[model samples]
Target: MNSPVASNESLVSVENVEKVFRRGSEEIHVLRNLDLQVAQGEFLALMGPSGSGKSTLLNLIGGLDRPSRGTLRVAGEDLHDLPDRKMAEWRARHVGFVFQLYNLMPVLNAERNVELPLLLTHLNRAERRQHVAAALDVVALSHRAKHYPRTLSGGEQQRVGIARAIVTDPTLLLCDEPTGDLDRKSGDEILNLLQALNREHGKTIIMVTHDPHASARASRTVYLNKGQLSTEPVI
Candidate 1:
């Protein structure tokens, strides 16, 4: 696969971004003047201690939250300027998120869970089924398609989550502690799957994680602290 980074095309660009949350008279500044660029097909990892705004930055990239200041562009769309409805639509079409806790609906089986993202699209039933099946195949979880979340192992459930995330073939993937809730073995399995997606499928991934081992798997690792980015080369 061609290296998107080598091509020098940015899939996500954040410049002088800040996120501030206000509660009553108090204000919490999560991210301050953060600038980052993720090239297409690059798997970038964000590392920071708790409250360092790592997850906040990921949410901004994924369009889950708007920055209080500065500009953010993902997949060529000006995320900061998009109306709520437009942002939701853009997110459905361009971004896929993998969370630490498998956010699968308890009642939905693996195949059904994978099919949820397609519900936002106009694809017909047949098309949706085809995409769901292909996503399950990508995660090698086709055999568990009929199993409910509770019946599946933690690893299997997370695989189903990955299947759901990729079913849309979104432009980029935002992962927040994707391996955080699993055991060591299961976590490694999840990381391997993420790596495969980035390497073989040309997926651009931005993952927020505290684990050094997880950061090592990404093409580049960036550090955040005190609501600011540190360009110090990763050792």
Candidate 2:
């Protein structure tokens, strides 16, 4: 795989990474010696076709899955070497995820949903509440704190998802097609929020997207094809 331009202060460093899955007797290769470097405070857009291993790569960087071969480092920790339990702890502290489908619990109100990640932390109830409030405010959804997911608009639910992701103040934000399900206007709103998070708050973000408009919001964009990183999309 070809390497993108290197960063001086890389928060994510993927070197010769490979990911594979097994289905019965068949071996599926999803990533092939991929190499990437994401600088701190950089908002990177990862573009690829369906089944191009974009989400798989995001999963690896976020410590949700392990690479089959080679080094994977994020926020200065070697994810490839961590045990499952340790990896879980590391991920909770260092990674936040925004899914394409909102992924909010139907029963929980906005604030409660945002507070979920803090539940795994050592913070007390009051402390968690403080964090949740600040996060909701960041997303401009404090007014909807008591509103459940079912009561909110598609865009509003995504805001809640963003709030939940940032409540932990994670080292990296791994977003998988975060705006895919929203309309153009709503998608722009989410992109604006993400841009503000990167520029004003210095949050490092890696977004997997198929839309060029979404990718255009990023500081840098890279393409993935056949499990390899490239400067141009493979056709």
Candidate 3:
């Protein structure tokens, strides 16, 4: 399975984390006192039913949202401590996100879409193109660089999204139901690509998925229920 041994140098560590939301005069707790650690180079899967707070936990790790309480340390930075602007900057540099919807810009071609995150960096135009090309090549989509999202198939579009996510070589790859919208064949292709990224490229990935088949590919699977962890990770 190539699951990594637990160590102190965890890439992601959530300690006593809790999340709550309020509407009008009522308060709802979403997550309660959760703790987790994902070692470097590990591919961890979070699985649960709808509204189980699986995505919420993924968001906290990806720096897309803040925890209402507790500490979130990812890639050695305390995400809970970073200000909004700094968090954005940190996310740009350290985290890559892949969504189920293949959030590509309809107006932009594949290469341009992959180049979006690099624009936030100090890379020049030429450098950005080089990075974009490399990323597309990694995903075996170099031939589709000039194609727009609307013209590509669902799997191809998701490949572009994957390319976009990895272009920056971020420290962490966060995937939220990355293959949710694809056919079984296409979803398997994407999962294979993600597996290659983890095993070959040594990318640290945390994926949220409901498919047990998909979760089976991960090094470990953790289940969440009712906004709380229901069981220890299944190997």
Q: Which model scores highest in lDDT? A: 2
- lDDT by residue (tens digit), candidate 3, 133-219: 999999999999999999999999999999999998988899999989999999999999999999999888999998988999999
> How far out, in Å, is residue 138 in model 3?
0.8
**lDDT (Cα, tens digit) per residue for candidate 2, span 63-84:** 9899999999898789998999
Between candidates 2 and 3, the one scoring higher on lDDT is 2
CA-lDDT, candidates in order: 0.90, 0.93, 0.90
Judged by whole-model lDDT over C-alpha atoms, candidate 2 comes out at: 0.93
Among all windows of 10 consecutive residues in model 1, the one with the lowest summed lDDT is 1-10
What candidate 1 gets wrong by more than 4 Å, as runs, is 1-7, 233-235
Off by over 4 Å in 2: 1-7
Residue 109's lDDT within candidate 3 is 95
RMSD of each: 2.5, 3.9, 3.3
TM-score of candidate 3 on Cα atoms, chains taken together: 0.95
Candidate 3 residue-pair clash tally: 0
